[model samples]
Target chain A: MPDGFDQFVTDRLDRLLRYATAMTCDRYLAQDIVQEALLRAQRRWGRIGAMDAPYLYVQRMVTNEYLSWWRRRASRDVASPATTIAALTPPVGDPAVHHAERDAMRARIAQLPRKQRAALVLRYYEDRSDAEIAEVLKCTAGTVRSHISRALKTLRADNRVMEVL
Target chain B: MTNDEMLIREAIGEEAGQAVDPGTVLAALHGGRKPRRSRGLAVAIAGVAVTAGIAGVMIPLTASRGDEAGPAAANAATGAQGEQTILVLGLDKLVDEGQRPDSIMLLRAGADGSFRALSVPRDSRIDPESKLNMAYLKAGGGDKGAQATAAEVEKLTGVRAQHYVTVAMTDFPELSTAVGGVEVCLKKAVNDQLSGANLPAGKQTVSGEQALAFLRQRRGLPNGDLDRIARHQAFLRGLAARLATLEPAKLTALVDTVKRTVHTDAALDVLGLARRLTSQSGLTAATIPTDGSVDTPSAGQALAVDPVKVRKFTTEFFGNGPAPAGGGAPNGTDTRTPCVN
Candidate 1:
């Protein structure tokens, strides 16, 4: 491994893990994703380290891994139960009712089409612009806009989401 | 525009901004790399050599992992909050090796939880008769280009850009690949010999290298640079949507990619702000409407932008709503006034 490979791993490992978690919506799966990506990155550490942005190479690896998983499953759903809950549930669960409400919201968001849901999360949660979101989602700005519009319409129409909000 | 939209943005922002330990990630990476030298190798004949080899590699991995985690972890935990503006500058004319800004876009997020995106064309002939990209190069490069470009955009759009994210041509590939690939829609089959990018009309996901080609293709495009800009916008929107689905590992990879390829004044907190914005719902996108024309200036012939239409578009996009006033819904409180049940 090159001298900076270890440092690169150390420096970026956490963010990569978080990103993987978000993408997979499964913590364990996220771990596996990161591990695999890191392993691949390590294997090509010398060549990668010489590149302008080796992390980009690792990122590509991780996303490709996730996409492969999606292709294998033939289902586009990426969110897990925990992720759905996490997205909806507030941190402090003092009241069971609130928890339930959060869960409902999560379920509603989960019910959205995969691409639409992804667009909502990226545009709103990640605060990425249409361009950035488009880059990440592998689509055009017009498509991104359509997704957002459709996602928002669905979210707004969801009785549960409307009630919760 | 609506209450639901605001609440959704607040909720998503809060959730996405939550902190996690970068140390664990570093440790995992190091642990994965640890050499597995069998203790009883060759019936103990190679024990000493194997043990030495393992220790030599393990020690540094552990040491480096240890030092790298703390600061990054701290940074992640202390992300930014509230309304902010981020400038994303695209250097259009410059190729991979060149360093400068060719185009600029301003993104503003208000406390009311609304967003506005504005773009300035690269070829817009300005006072000095130089293309918009020259402003960045003349101001220095990289961070300097961002600052200079931001200042110029403020003059053009009448909105102050708070911070900027500058990406080189190479950064685009790294970035596009980092989040997987971006999907682009082609209206017609594109075979641009100059940029070496060929594609049939339709929807397709492109990798980093391909993305670079897509963004660079100019000739054969109906609107020329204008069409390219639209294509760039489409690519970005797709990329953002793709990123939204990223698992933690991929998100971390994105952060790493940003650290490597992007130059920005945005603090870790601001990136956090970006994360929150992405996690939210109801974000709207619109282009700064413009009618392109040719103009002759002291510098030479250049693309002329209709300043009046640009100004009107800017005001219309960003001026409708009141400036966002505060951070997301009060922490730990789901203030959504339930509408359904």
Candidate 2:
């Protein structure tokens, strides 16, 4: 690719990393997803990078890679040696603290089904509209709404969140 | 967004600022690009085509011992991404007579959608005197027939099949009718009771029962199974040529017909074949070339197959290496050189 493309990736790397990390919860998995998307983006840099929303297009590829998990299941099955589940697990501190409820809720969000978790993350974290999320997830906007509705309902049912509501 | 949504989003983004090495991601994509391709293609003969088409030349002669037409069921197969070698069979069931594996053809479909078809005559001896078709009968019926036929093909050609699709003979009529019928020509009229074929001389469009009869009859024709193989080649060429001219809707129906009538072993189904099809290079049908005739005391009359000839043909038409300098191999459609004696 052109030198400008390298500079572009260098500049946007942290943002893409943030999106991947938030979607996957695991740091290693997020890096892998971002890497696959970038490699694909590099191949189409001239066309895609020129588009108004190149970052969104690559983010969609990352989402697709996660959904089409069967293709890379064999190699990725191994847990990353460095990023222990305990280290990345939410609710890292002791239970009797002020942040207890918030941590517990984050854990529940992580436990949600993949699509629902993706929908919820794209909506609340990245501030994507339902139509934007649908484009990324390759589904109807109605389906995306249903996913968010279900995820939020599950979260709301949690006694701690119920108290807050 | 609700309060819970805001809180949840805030908690999820706690560790989003961590920097990951860009080198790591790019390396994974480059390092693991290949080695995922699974070799071998499963093949089965779709026995019939009832849907008529615009035009087709070879009428596959098949006899079914059955009460009514039934769906054969296409299945899936596993193959490499770039090119796949599939075994396409034409199967028939005679009432109380058992299943007859009438035609065997190996189709090599490239990543580019270029395909080359090689037909193996039923009379081609698997052993010194035994015919290739007997493999199905020897193994009994159902999946055993598919296995036995696949084994014979592997032994004959160097290609090892990992998947297959077997289709019923009756399904051809529906396919034939859908294409406005396949056109078949003959120099003289023919009458064959065994195959239920009675046709006049000259060119005619055949469909339904008539199409099946036209494809199934090779008894009176002195060449026997060899003539039938030619008819099979002609049938494929006719189908390919006709499909090239058909409306997309007609082609889709034909694909559906193949999907319904054929049974495959792996996930590589007819729809998969249809979707990947592009830049159709050319279609050539050829038989496993034999050097001379041989009559073995144990196996009766079998073609004296030249192994050297088979190797040359495969290398020319199917090898991954550069295509041979000259035109690959002699085609079955070329009536100039008699493919079968």
TM-score for each model: 0.46, 0.46
lDDT of 1 at B100: 49
**Model 2 spans with C-alpha error above 4 angstroms:** A1-165, B1-80, B94-97, B187-204, B252-257, B269-272, B279-281, B291-301, B319-341
- Worst 10 contiguous positions by lDDT, candidate 1 chain B: B46-55
List candidate 1 stretches off by more than 4 Å: A1-165, B1-82, B92-98, B112-115, B142-144, B266-268, B271-275, B281-284, B320-341
Cα lDDT tens digits for candidate 1, A38-64: 877788888989988676567657766
The TM-score between candidate 1 and the true structure equals 0.46
Q: State the local distance difference test value for candidate 1.
A: 0.52
Cα distance off (Å), candidate 1, residue B265: 2.3
Per-prediction DockQ scores? 0.06, 0.10
- Provide backbone clash counts, one per model: 80, 62
At residue A23, candidate 1 shows an lDDT of: 49
